[model samples]
Target: MNDLIPLISSSINDTLASLSHFYAEIILAAGFLLVILADLFLSRRFTQLCFLISLSTLLLLGVQSVILLNTKTVFLFGGMLKLDHTSILFKLLFCFSSLLFAIFIRYNSPLQKHVKGTGDLFAILLATLLGMNLLAMSMNLLMVYISIEMVSLGSYLMVSYISADKAQTESAMKYALFGAVCSAIMLYGISLLYGFTGTLNFNDPAFINALKNVSGLSSGVAISLVFIGVAFKLSIAPLHFWAPDVYEGAPTPVTAFLSTAPKIAGFAILIGLLPVFQSEGGQTNTQYFDFNVILAVLATASMLIGNFTAIWQNNVKRMLAYSSIGHTGFMLMALFAFQGSGFQALIFYMAVYIVMNMAAFLIVDEIEEQTGILLIDEYKGMGKSNAMLMTTFVIVLVSLTGLPPTVGFTAKFLVFSSAFEAYRNTDSAVILIMIITAAISTLVSLFYYFKIPLNAFLRNSQIQVMAPGNSPKAYLGLLLAILLLVLIVFPSVIVKLI
Candidate 1:
C-alpha cells in the first residue's frame, strides 16, 4: 500500500503537466457540456439559441487549435496521446467540417422543423468533434479504442436525430450493431497485443521489439484484427457495408461530416502506425507481413467495388457514399509513402475532400428542399432555371472526378506523385499496381459523377420544375466550388502547409 502511493502521486503530477498542453481538447470538453446545458435550460425560450452557441464554440475551438499547433511534439496524459503538427492539422479539419455542418443544419428546414429539436443535434456534433480530436492525437492502444467508440456513439445519435422515417431508425440501429462488433474485434486484438507486449503504448520501443520477437503469423493476425475497426471507420471494402445506407438515411450535413472528418481521423491513426510497417529494421522481420500488399489489395478491391456499385446507384447520397469508399482506397495509396511527402499529400487531400463534399451535399440538399428531387434522373434540365447552382455542381463533380481546374485534381496528383516516389525508391510492385488501379477507378468514377451534369443540362426535363434560383445554401456551395478552382490555380496554398 505504501508503494502504490508513489505511483498515484506520479500519475497526478503527470496529469497536471499535461493540462497545459491540452487546451484545445479541454475547450472541446467544456464546449460539449455548455452546449448540452444550454439546450436543456435555454432552448425553450430561443429556438436557434443552441445553434448560435454551437457555431461560436466551434469557431473558438478552431482558434484554440491554431494556437496549439506551435506546441512541440510531446506526449500528454501520461503518454496516452501526443501533440504534433499532423494531429493538429487533423483537428483543424474536424472543426471545419463541424462548422460546415452547423450551418448546414441551420439551412435544413426539415431538421429545423423536427419535433425532437435541433439543439441535441448540435450537442452531438460537439461530442463527436471532441472524439475525433482525441482520435487524431491518441498514442496509446487504450486511448485509440475509447476515442473510436466515442465518435461511433455520437454518430449513432446524429443518424437517428430526426427518425422521421423507418429508414433513418434502421440505419441508426445498423450503425450501432456493426460498430459494436468492430469494437469487440479491435478490443480482442488490443488484448492479444497487450498480452504479447505487456505494453499499451504502441510508440514505446519495447512494443515493436516485442512484436519482432513474436511469431510472424501471430503478429499478422493481431494486427489484422485491430485494423478491422479502422477499416470500418474509413469505409474500406468488406467493412463498408454500413456506409451506403447510413449516408442515404442521414441528414445531408451529417453525411458530409461522416464521409470526410472521421475518415481523415482514421488515417491519422494509420500515420502513427507508420513505424510498425516499415521494413528498415531487419530484426523486426517487418517484411514478413507486407502491409503494403495487404493495403494495396484492399485498395484495389475498394476502388472496383465502390466505383462499380456507384454506377448503379440512382440516389445522389448513396452514390457519393460509395464513391467515398473508393476515395478511401485512393487515399490509402498516400500511406505507401508515409514518411515522405505522403503525409503532406494526405492532409491536402483531406482538406480538399472536405470542401468538395460540403459543396456536393449543399447542392443536393438545396435541390431536394426546392423541388423534392433525390434521384439523379430527376435533376434533368435544372441548369436552365438554376444555372449558377448547376455550374457549381458541375465544377464540384469535375473536381470529385479528379479532373483539371479543381483542387481535387491537385490533391490526387500530389498523392500520386508521393506514391510514385515511394515506388521509385523501393521498386515495390504493389505500389505500381495500386497506382494503376487508382487511375482506372478515377476513370470509372467519371461515368457516375458526370451523370449530374448530363441530366441537369444535356438531358431535357420530363417533369415540371419548381422555381430553384435563390438560396443561401446554394451560394455557400458555389463559394466552396469556386474555392476548389482557386486552390487548384494556387496549389501552393495547401502545399505550403505540407
Candidate 2:
C-alpha cells in the first residue's frame, strides 16, 4: 500500500506537466461545451452564434498547433498520449478541415435550407475534431480505442442528423451498424493483445517483446483483427461498401468531411501501431504475419477495385467515394513504402489531397445548387453556361488526376518517387506489384475524372443553365483550387511545412 503513494504522486506530476502541452485541446473542450450552451440560449436571437464560436475555437486551436510544431516529444496522461511533430502536423490539418466544414455548413444550400438548425452540426464537428486530435496523438491501445469510438460515434450521428429522405435514414443505419461490428472486432483484438502482453501501452518495449514470445499464428490473427477494424474505418476494400451509399445519400458537406478528415486520423493510428509489429535485430519477424506484404496486397486491390468501379459510377459523389477508396489504397502504399523520405511524401500527399477533395465537393455543391446536376449525364454542356465555374472544376479534376502544373501532380510525384526508392532499397516484389497497380489505377481514374469535363464541355445540353449565385463555398473552393496550382509551382511550400 505504501508503494502506491509514490506511483500516484508521479502520475499526478506527469499529468500536470502534460497540461501545458494540452492547452489547445483544453480550448477545444471548453469551446465544445460553450457552443452547446450558446446554441441553447443565444441561437434564438443570433442564429450564427454557435458557428462563430466554433470557428473561433478552431482558429485558436490551429494557432496552438502551429506554435507547438517544434516542441520536443513528450508523453501525456501517463503515456496514453504522445505529443510529437507528426501529431502536431495532423492536428493542424484537422483544424483546417473543420474550418472548411464550418464554412461549408454556412453556405451549403441543402443544409442551410433544412429545417434542422446548423448549430448542432457545429458542435458535433468540434467534438469530432477533438477526437481526431486525440486519435492522432494516442500512443496506447486504450487511448486508441477510446478516440476511435469517439470519432466513429460522432460520424454516425453526423450522417444521420439531418436525415431528410429514406435514403439518408438507410445510409445512417448502415454506417452505424457496420461501424459497430468493426468496433467490436477491434475491441476483441485489443483484448487478445492485452491478455498476451499485459499492457495497453503499445509503445512500451514490453508490448513488442511479449508479442514476440507469443505463438506465431496467435499474434498474427490478433494483430490482423485490429488492422481490419482500422481499415474498415478508412473504408478500405472488402469493408468499403458503405462509403458510396453514404456519400451519395448524406449531405454533400458531410460527405466531404467524411472523406478527408477521418481517413487522415485512421492513417495516424496505423502509423503509430506499425512500429509495434516490425522485427528487431535484423531478424525475421515471423511471430506476426507478413505485415508489409498484406498491406501491399490491400493497397493493390483497393486501387484496382476503387478505380475500376468508379468508371461505371453515375452519381458524382459516388464516383468520388470510389476514388477516395482508391486514394486510401494509394496512401496505404505510401505507408507500406515509408522509409526516410517516404514519410514526408505521405504527409505532403495528404495535405494536397485535403485541398483537392474539398474543392471538388464544394464546386459540385455549387453546380448542384444552380443547375441541380447530380449525375454525370446531367453535366452535358453545362460548362457552356457556367464557364468559369466549370473551368475551375476542370482544373480541380486535373489536379486530382495528378497532371502537370497542379499540386496534386507534385504530391503524387513525391509519393511515387519515394515508393520507387523503397522498392530499390528492399527489392520486394509486393512493393513492385503495388507500384504497378498504382500506376494503372491513376490512368483508370482519368476516365472517371475526365468524364466531368468531357460531359460539361464537349457534350451538348439543351436545357438552359443559370450562373451560380454569389456563394461563399464556391469562392473558398476556388481559392483552394488556385492554392493547388500555386503549390505545384512552388512544391516545396507545403512539402517543407509538413
- TM-score against native, each model: 0.97, 0.98
Worst 10 residues of 1 by lDDT: 276-285
Please provide the root mean square deviation of candidate 2 (C-alpha atoms, Å): 1.4
Worst 10 residues of 2 by lDDT: 279-288
TM-score top scorer:
2
Go through the candidates in order and give each one's C-alpha lDDT: 0.87, 0.88
Query: Which clashing pairs does model 1 show?
Result: none
Give the Å shift of residue 403 in candidate 1.
Answer: 1.3
Best candidate (score: lDDT): 2
In candidate 2, how many Å is residue 264 off?
A: 0.3
Per residue, candidate 1 scores C-alpha lDDT tens digits across 302-395 of 9889998999999999999999999999888888787888888888998999999989999999988988899998889888867888899999
